[model samples]
Target: MAAASGTRPEHMAPAEVFYDGTEAKKYTSSSRIIDVQAQMAHRCIELMALPPGHRCFILDIGCGSGLSGEALSSAGHAWVGTDISADMLTVGLARGTPGDTLLSDMGQGLPFRTGSFDGAISVSAVQWLCYATQKSHQPYRRIRAFFASLYRCLKRGARAALQIYPENAAHLEMLSAAAAKAGFRGGLVVDFPNSTKAKKYYLCLVAGSGERDDSAAAATSAAGAAAGAAADSSSSSASDGDLKHSDAAMEATDGMGSAMTSSGLVVAMGRRSSSDFEKRRRSRAQDRVGAHAPARKEWVLRKKEQRRAKGLPTRSDSKYTGRRRPDRIT
Candidate 1:
């Protein structure tokens, strides 16, 4: 069946693949959000000062391809990531990074038991929830639900860092209000000295000791259904629908019965930081590559040696590790 006039955004659909698209691809190579990583490491180091078992349990929501996970793992923090796109997850899984990765939708209530996470972080992913709404779709609530679900899964006394885009007063107000209502405290931090786009935003929210909001779920469900319906069909000519639908279908090379028209994301990290978050992030970005990963290379070489010894194919097109050697990243 044809997709309705407004389904997924332009950068959505096989949304997982966008992780490799130009913007994120650049961010990946250059580490544009490297500062975010440093901040995360600094906060984690501070948390480390706490007695054992006190360090935060991190959740990287929409943690596309484990970019954030790799950073957290490198710094020695326990983290788990979840996203709706398995294709993205596949890349992450292949990397064999530390921590577990789950496939789940951010717009849905997370799979964790209540308050299971110590803190949560999201990067370059929330904007998908805020895509322009059609007449009948309440895209705002999807954005709201995205935050609400994060609030529900994180423990009290924990923090959340969310970065959102198209920086404007209106969006800031929307984020602040929704977070407070969902039981998080600690005001907004706007870090843009240049322009809205360059403006780094941080919502360093501390979950309240108060009770969770009961009404968000029903409203969220209604909104998800609304998003599922795509935009209103009555207003746009049936004529346009055919053309738009045809275009969307033609663009969907990855299947999953969806496509994106346009997309953007702002990444943010949340955790317990007395104040060292920024410093830690800066230090982390500058971390030296250990002169050598001899142990790591030895392990890989041994595996290949073992395969060769056993007369098994040492190289193959398959992505499985034991099945074939790897294409190393830095």
Candidate 2:
């Protein structure tokens, strides 16, 4: 909830210390938090691309107060959730959440066995691993250990869609690198990237060789395409009021051979081709050489004329005054 208002609770305290009994109850009872968590959970499942009509045993990492677990159950999947906060798990038990809850620190690594779950989903988690709350906690090592354990617990070809609120580009890069190092294939899938409030980052990862059913792969691709379409639509809508301005700005940037977009999205607009780069390089080289080269004959003559008009003695102009002599025949 603090993250919603631009305040990161992870910065204030560790997950276990922040989400105490009072905070857990408040988070569970908030309608907005419940709805947002549910939406993100559904999106995570979509990104997972689980087979249709088949029940899956999923792992819900950092399933705070079982809100996201409730979503997994709604999709007809059985999920076991793990959280670092005991009070949160207690509150989830009191609420009669469908999934079983375990009290464990994810940064220490998941407790599940190898290939135990069909897929995994995490909502508003993972970012905590990038921060060190204890003296023994090394962000990179903890991230590496957590991802390694998660990768082992997942069946080959299974996916884990973890929705994280990265603090910055560096944190995002660290998490991604750690996941890749753990042997998971795939990359980040960002939805509604143009909107500050609606933008979400999902690290969609595949376990092992990624030899999954074709239908599942198609589903994943379709989901990614749909997210792209949504982002485009949102961007277009946001710039509708300033369409002409946006177009003009884009044109100016393009004219300058810049690869930046007018709306500041990651989408590149005026990427120069190889020939364009070559031409620009040649032009710059010519300018650098010309800056230090001797003045042309016409320039020397003009300067002499200016000196004469200033009443200073100047060289007389003749046919050869600004002409170079021919080379003698060898």
| Candidates' C-alpha lDDT | 0.51, 0.76
Best by lDDT: 2
Which ranges of candidate 2 are over 4 A from the true structure?
1-5, 213-218, 231-330
> What is the Å distance of residue 226 in model 1 from its true position?
42
lDDT of 1 by residue, 136-220 (tens): 5465676667667777787766666554332234545566666666666654333322221232334556666533223222322
Task: Give the Å error, residue 258, model 2.
Answer: 14
For residue 293, give model 2's deviation from the true position in Å: 23
Model 2: residue 303 alpha-carbon error in angstroms? 46
List TM-scores for all candidates, in order.
0.51, 0.70
Q: Residue-wise lDDT of candidate 2 within 105-196, one digit each (tens)? A: 98888998999999999988888898999998999999999999999999999999998777666677788788888988776665664444
